[model samples]
Target: MLKITDLHVQLEEEDKKILKGVNLTVETGKVHAIMGPNGSGKSTLSYVLSGREGYEVTQGSAELDGEEILEMDPEERAAAGLFLAFQYPVEIPGVGNMTFLRTAVNAQRKARGQEEMSATDFLKEVRAKAKSLKIDADMLKRPVNVGFSGGEKKRNEILQMAMLEPRMCILDETDSGLDVDAMKLVADGVNALRDEGRSFLVITHYQRLLDHIKPDVVHIMADGRIIKTGGPELALEVENNGYADLLEGTA
Candidate 1:
């Protein structure tokens, strides 16, 4: 569902390359995990794929279902079924979570030339999705991520993913700040969304998240490139040893 071909990215201002020939494919129904140390361009790949600014794709292409996506605007990318679960979900003090979700859902539908969901239908759907993510109605009434705990924020991201139902979900360190229980909850929400048509590219520095998510493939990234690719065992190796052995082995 997602494909990258020799993708090279660099900061527009400083001209420092971040992703060097990042070629990856996340097929339909598969979960792919990317584990790497800081500054290795793991997050960079996600940002670039999501059409974030400040980074320029100097070479190669990113395609979703054979459609080129790099030149599209961020919202257009969203309309095209691309979703990025931020490493840090920003707070919107003025927007209620429910309202924000409704707006997003309707906006995407409108962009795709579909009718807006009625209030009753939207409410029922949102509530059901929230329940699956362990998000209560009270939390839905609160401002988006304004006062949520770390776990709450992460779960909220999952809620967005569930509601949007993007074809390819790019999760950037979704487990960064969560406790063990919180991580499991977030993982459960993600796992619950797994299906024959959906794919996941989970980027993390640790394997604990993968322990619950159980990716079909695990990739080791370093020096702005994917240095090695393996199955779930790769994540275990990273957890047992650190990036040290992996880095040395690659060297």
Candidate 2:
């Protein structure tokens, strides 16, 4: 569903390379997990894929399905079925959670030439999805992430992903701050959406998340490049020993 080839990205201001000739291909219907230590450019890869500012793609190409997405704006990428769950979900003090979600969903539908979802249908979906994520009505009425806990914010991100139902999901450290219960809820929500036509690119630092959301492939990234690709055992390897050996050329 997503293919990135020789993607060389660097900060435009600093000119310091973050992703050096990175190549990855996430197949349709498969879950691919990327595990790396700090400074491995893991989050940078997700940011670049999402078309965030401050980073320039010096070379290489990123394609969703068959169309190149590097030239598209962030909104275009979202309309094209690219979703990024941020590591730290920003707080919007003025907008209600429900309002924000409904706006985003309708915007994407409009972009795809589909009719805007009526308020009745949108409310039904919002309620149903919120229930699945254990989000209450009061939470929905509140401003987006305004007073939510870390776990709540992460679940909110998953809720957004579930509502939009993007074809390619890029989860950037969705497991960063969650406790056991919160992580399980987030994982269950994600697993429920697994489909033959949808794919996931889970970028994480730890294997605990992988235990809940098993990946079809595990990749070890280091020094701005993916150096090792293996099955699920690879995540276990990192969990048991960390990225030291992976970085020192032993593993």
Across residues 1-251, which tens digit of lDDT does each residue of candidate 2 receive?
Answer: 89999999999999699999999999999999999989999999999999999999999999999999999999999999999999999999999999999999999999999999999999999899989999999989999999899999999999999999999999999999999999999999999989999999999999999999999999999989999999999999999998898888844
Candidate 1 wrongly placed segments (more than 4 Å): none
lDDT of 1 by residue, 196-219 (tens): 899999999999999899999999
| Whole-model Cα lDDT of every candidate shown, in order | 0.94, 0.95
Instruction: Rate residue 39 of model 2 by lDDT.
Output: 95
TM-score of model 2 (CA atoms): 0.99
Q: Count clashing residue pairs per candidate.
A: 0, 0
- Candidate 1 RMSD computed on C-alpha atoms after optimal superposition onto the true structure: 0.8
Q: Can you tell me which runs of candidate 2 are displaced by over 4 Å?
A: none
